[model samples]
Target: MRTHWLSSCLVLLITTLAVAQKNTQGISGQVLWKAGNFMPTIGTKASVPKAVPVVREVYIYALTNDKQVDAGEDAGFYQKVNSKLVRKVKTDKKGRFSVTLPVGYYSVFTKEEKGLYANLFDDAMNINPVQVQKRRWTKMDVVVDYQAVY
Candidate 1:
């Protein structure tokens, strides 16, 4: 009798936990610069450089508010905004990025510079709406249209 009751309780707990799980999924995309936009190398003797989108490492941030993360506040560039640090991720060497987040709405953007995660640099561009869905990957690609902070 005791064994039967324990098994029933265990089953109930498992079901409840499963039902309580949040609808979270993976989000992935790439940051790219148009190949044609970059012209021949200045220092290189080669006139025709390989035409391809430049793959680089950049900073990415997920925000829950309409306010920009590092909006012109030089200090905000490298400082981690603990108040709104929902998800911060960096793109791979190929400029491919992936992050798992709960299903909901978020404003996403990328910083021009790669390092400076803990130091102030400059504001980011390409701010846009991002949505995560349940049980699937959401693809959102962004292009670096502005110059990186030196």
Candidate 2:
């Protein structure tokens, strides 16, 4: 009787583990450089360059998408709880990036170079992120105004 009970318990535990693993999903996304300021040539004395610089070294964070959790406080919450690196990725030569993460809602974080570099979406990316669905394989898009801090 003792051996039969132990065997049954082991089987139950294995089944639970298998079921949990089956529910996991993979999440992914890409990053791009925001368009540069396009001043009208007709009005300006000097024409601005049409090409934009590539952004790099942007860091991403994951957070729970709950009603009580203020979306505006995501960065601060991540800093307090997930201060360590969740994942690190860089933009390719064409300013494209892809990262694979487990299914979960996440907030995007971008690091802009402190020097003469100009990054527009630094604060916004740090502020709030849209709730990401985590069921199966998923993909999303991210844009950065300034280059990521290397």
Candidate 3:
């Protein structure tokens, strides 16, 4: 019957998807900040005695681990494509985050990219990178230690 054939096809598709499941891993961490003694910028040095802001939201990125890919002529195209492949995660309250990603190399970061002060530390250094492997949970901690230039 026609109904029987349709059911058979649907069952076949579901089985194929389950068999092709990709192995993935989880990543979790906190974003902490240490009070700064000084942050030198633009030929001027400023002192930050104590600045313990809330550690509410931290960003985690499972970035594509290829830095040597040359865009060549179409430089903008490469950046666009690579940005699309980035796996981004944000922490919840209490500075906690967990993300499941495919097994591969990744570059993690804790940079803040929101709010009116977002562009303040544009020239600051990036956070250290971390790697995640197959079916494993990687616990990585990040620290923020920069002050505003102005």
What are the per-model C-alpha RMSD values against the true structure? 10.7, 13.1, 13.4
Cα-lDDT of candidate 2: 0.49
**Which of the two, 2 or 3, has more lDDT?**
2
The pairs that clash in candidate 1 are: 78-119
List, residue by residue over 23-130, the lDDT tens digit for candidate 2.
Answer: 755444555554555546665587453434355665655542333233233223222223334676777766566565665555555555331121222233433343
lDDT of each: 0.54, 0.49, 0.48
Model 3 regions lying over 4 Å from their true place: 1-24, 38-85, 113-127, 148-150
Candidate 1 Cα outliers beyond 4 Å, as residue runs: 1-24, 34-70, 73-83, 114-126, 147-150
Name the top TM-score candidate.
1
Prediction 3 global C-alpha lDDT: 0.48
Better of 1 and 2 by lDDT: 1
lDDT comparing candidate 1 with the true structure? 0.54
**Per-residue lDDT of model 3, residues 1-150, tens digit only:** 999999999999988855543344767777555554545456556555543434444333334333422233421112212333355556665566777766655555444432101111112222234567876778866545444221
Clashes of 1: 1
Per residue, candidate 1 scores C-alpha lDDT tens digits across 1-150 of 999999999999998855644344757888765333344367767544232344544443454332434344543233332234466677777778877877775555555463222222224432355667787678877655443322
> Which residue pairs clash within candidate 2?
56-148, 111-149, 119-146
**Of candidates 3 and 2, the better by TM-score:** 3
Candidate order by decreasing TM-score: 1, 3, 2
